[model samples]
Target: MKGMIVSRPTEGDLPVSLDDLGAAARERWGAWVTERHTSVVPNAVLTLEVEPPGEPEFTVEVMRGPRSINLDGTPVQNYATAAWLRSLMPADAPRVIVFDDAWSMHADLTYGCTAEGLRAGTVDHSVPGWDAGDPDLY
Candidate 1:
């Protein structure tokens, strides 16, 4: 006898911040660079839209993290992350697949799931959106 497994897709929002990402990386790797140090590094906050085979869009944040400077929260689990990515699939889209880090723990579970997609290359990375620049920070 043969068995088959099927998964369904889900839809929701995902929030992310770079504020604690640097610290987290440093904590895990002992050495890490802040986003400000990398020209390619995205802004501190972002909202990613996920849809299988479809381009994802990045929206800027109107407000900063609760801490004002850093974020605080629990990281998303691998299974939950994978489920969220699967939810982004269209009826005919291929099975959602992902493998990456989970850094947006401070973000809601939904957002954390989406972050997985972002890291896994499941979501589009070409969206041109970012928070307004602050001269003081620069």
Candidate 2:
């Protein structure tokens, strides 16, 4: 999910900036900024590589979509990015119920589905983790 800096929490959607999502991913997802490119798309996605223990290290694009953190090969469709982030830790922890205080972490679960161009320029085919021929989002 995306991140935001709100003056006050509103019941409606929170205004999330590209930078906000980047900060949140770095802070909560154990992600390190891999690349910052303007040519990626209108969103100008902030790509981050996550090296979770025991799991294949992969990329997570912050500001990936309207309300999601797009993982490279291991895409998380409707799931909470924060929970998925934490799940990638040394071990998967119990899922936490996301509250209003942390809406960015709360997302629905659509495992492995990705939007077009989500992995456009970010995947390194030379790398072993993302060479699954890619998936066509149905």
**Per-prediction backbone clash count:** 3, 5
| Residue lDDT tens for model 2, 1-138 | 233111211222223555665566667654433445343645535666666666556655544332334444343322334344433322322222222223322221222323322223233333554435433210
How close is every model to the real structure, measured as TM-score? Answer: 0.21, 0.35
Q: Which stretches of candidate 1 lie over 4 Å from their true place?
A: 1-13, 32-36, 40-138
Query: Which consecutive 10 residues in model 1 have the weakest lDDT in total?
Result: 1-10
lDDT of each: 0.28, 0.38
Candidate 1 lDDT, 90-138, residue by residue in tens: 4444222332223111121232345554434332223332112522110
In terms of lDDT, which candidate is strongest? Answer: 2
Candidate 1 C-alpha error for residue 41, in Å: 7.5
